[model samples]
Target: MTTLEPAAVADLVRNTLAAHKSLFLATAGSTGPWVGGVYFAESGEFTLNLVLEDRGRTLAAIRENPVVSVVVSTGSPMQPFLQAQALAEILGRDEDARARELLVTKVPEAAPFLAAPVTAVRLSIRKWRATDIANGVLPGAELPSPRLP
Candidate 1:
């Protein structure tokens, strides 16, 4: 098993995050596991910003359990996609301004959606695993060692 260089893997992850419009967020709830699609913007190399309905189940679940999994993909076999393990947090009012800017900058169509009652979320990505068959990278080939520093 050959491990790709960290720089190469980082670039793949960054490009995938930039090209994708949304991500599938999976959280554990009292009922069970729940998954939902939500628009996101990369706030940093290891963090994502999201605007979710304040009363939504996803947020409710996050409040109960901060650990979550997120996937950034278009569901195309020919393209690259990434899976990440992250810790979720509901941003406070003071942090919302910056998160909102990042979201609007990435997805202009999301501006109106911000008007509704919603809150900003931050996903602190811990590890990234990616697959790019087009690049001859098989599944799990790009998994980071242990976790991101």
Candidate 2:
């Protein structure tokens, strides 16, 4: 088993985010836990920006419970993995411009569909767990919530 310092862990997380464009977001809805794959962009340190339908189940679930879980992986065994619990803040229409811009810039194909009836959600990571077994960091390690930017 290998170990990683907090700074290294943070860097690893950032690198993982930079290498991936989408993550699995899990939220608790009135019905139950709902998971959705959303394209994301790192808006700031420890903050991720994603757009979702304003009236979609994911957004609805976020409104009901602002705390959500997110996972980013390559669908491979355990080489790259990041799981985080974050506080979800639904951006108001007026405040979502930047988020939309970031998303569109990262995913140009999504531009036309980002118009009205859609809004941005910022996930502020609270606690996180990560591992890169392929790199020899076996098992995994959980880190305390890093400082917010």
Candidate 3:
């Protein structure tokens, strides 16, 4: 069994988001169907930005089921064997105004997109978990005897 330090977990989340420019967002539609997409970011935040029109299923899903999961990976085919996989989970909904503001930071290219009908949302992270797949153990598994930061 492995243990992950708080700092290590935070770093993994940040690095994973930064390294992977695109994210596969999964959402539920009005009828309880799963919808997913590859979305670009204008910046890194607990929240994400996308064209509202493009997220018909997502929006409806959020309305019906606000609970959602976001998976950010290294996109490495060798990830499984490595024992350490970097990923983050964001749970919540995006607030239009707040999401738009944050989006501008990561994706300045969305300036025009903001004006174009869009729904901005934020994912409030209720709980987060990170692991070092390479270690073949959970996060923080190999702690130094001294427990150095």
lDDT winner among the candidates?
A: 1
- Among the numbered candidates, top TM-score falls to 1
lDDT of 3 at 140: 30
lDDT assessment of candidate 2: 0.84
For model 3, the superposed segments whose C-alpha errors exceed 4 Å read: 38-51, 77-95, 135-149
Give the distance in Å from residue 115's predicted Cα in candidate 2 to where it truly belongs: 2.5
Per-prediction TM-score, please? 0.91, 0.90, 0.62
Report lDDT (Cα) of residue 11, candidate 3.
58
lDDT score at residue 58, model 3, on the 0-100 scale: 67
TM-score: model 1 vs. ground truth: 0.91
lDDT of 3 by residue, 57-79 (tens): 66666766766665555555334
lDDT score, residue 45, model 2?
Answer: 44
The clash numbers for all candidates, in the given order, read 0, 0, 21
lDDT of 3: 0.50
lDDT of 2 by residue, 1-149 (tens): 77988888778887888888889999997979999998898865478899988778999999999999999888786658888889999888776888999988888877876866788989999766888998866666676665742
Give the Cα error of residue 127 in candidate 1, in Å. Answer: 0.8
